[model samples]
Target: MCSRDLKTPWIDLNTLMRGQRRVLLRHGERPYQLSITRRGRLILTAADQDTDTAAAAAPPGKARS
Candidate 1:
């Protein structure tokens, strides 16, 4: 591996979260949620990809009957 590839990639949580309570991260076909809990701690967990994607794909204030 090149020396550049050996370096660790890192970012500050505050910069990443950016005042948001949660952010969705995609890993290939899978989706994961990164969130700040009420206690100010971080949590990472698998999200329901199908449901989340569908909801996001939906238009604002629109719903399927």
Candidate 2:
């Protein structure tokens, strides 16, 4: 769905975040959240209120993991 030709598998944080603290991604009936941590790290997880929060770490050197 990306329009620009990507030389490498990389995306600008500013562009992706779009100045928001969190972004929601919908898949069928489930919604996932992409958020910025207090330490300026990135986290992606299921957005269900009752579900446990599991965040995958950002790539090495991208943030303090």
Candidate 3:
């Protein structure tokens, strides 16, 4: 199984396909979004507790189609 640092949230790249909306996981009672770009890059985002700008997790894999 893939494991991640508990210090940060993890989003699976394969799960984020273009034009989808779903909750991948939760952090401290808040949900995060997993999505893909038209270019097929996977994305992970969480609301920054200190600001409106979303805090993004690192992409999980090497850029691949």
Candidate topping lDDT: 1
Better of 2 and 3 by lDDT: 2
Clashes by residue pair, model 3 = none
Instruction: State, as a TM-score between 0 and 1, how close model 3 is to the true structure.
Output: 0.34
**lDDT by residue (tens digit), candidate 1, 1-65:** 44666467868998886666676778899888776766788778786845464443343334523
- Regions more than 4 Å wrong, model 3: 1-24, 47-65
lDDT of 2 at 4: 70
Distance from true position, residue 6, model 2, in Å? 7.7
Which ten residues in a row are the worst by lDDT in model 3?
51-60
Ranking by TM-score: 1, 2, 3
Worst 10 residues of 1 by lDDT: 56-65
Off by over 4 Å in 1: 1-6, 51-65
lDDT of 2 by residue, 1-65 (tens): 65876765887988976776666666898888787877998878776643332222333224322
Error of 2 at 61 (Å): 24
Q: Give lDDT per model, in order.
A: 0.66, 0.63, 0.46
lDDT, residue 35, candidate 2: 79
Over 1-65, each residue of candidate 3 has an lDDT whose tens digit, in order, gives 36666877665544443334322445777766555555765466763344221223334432312
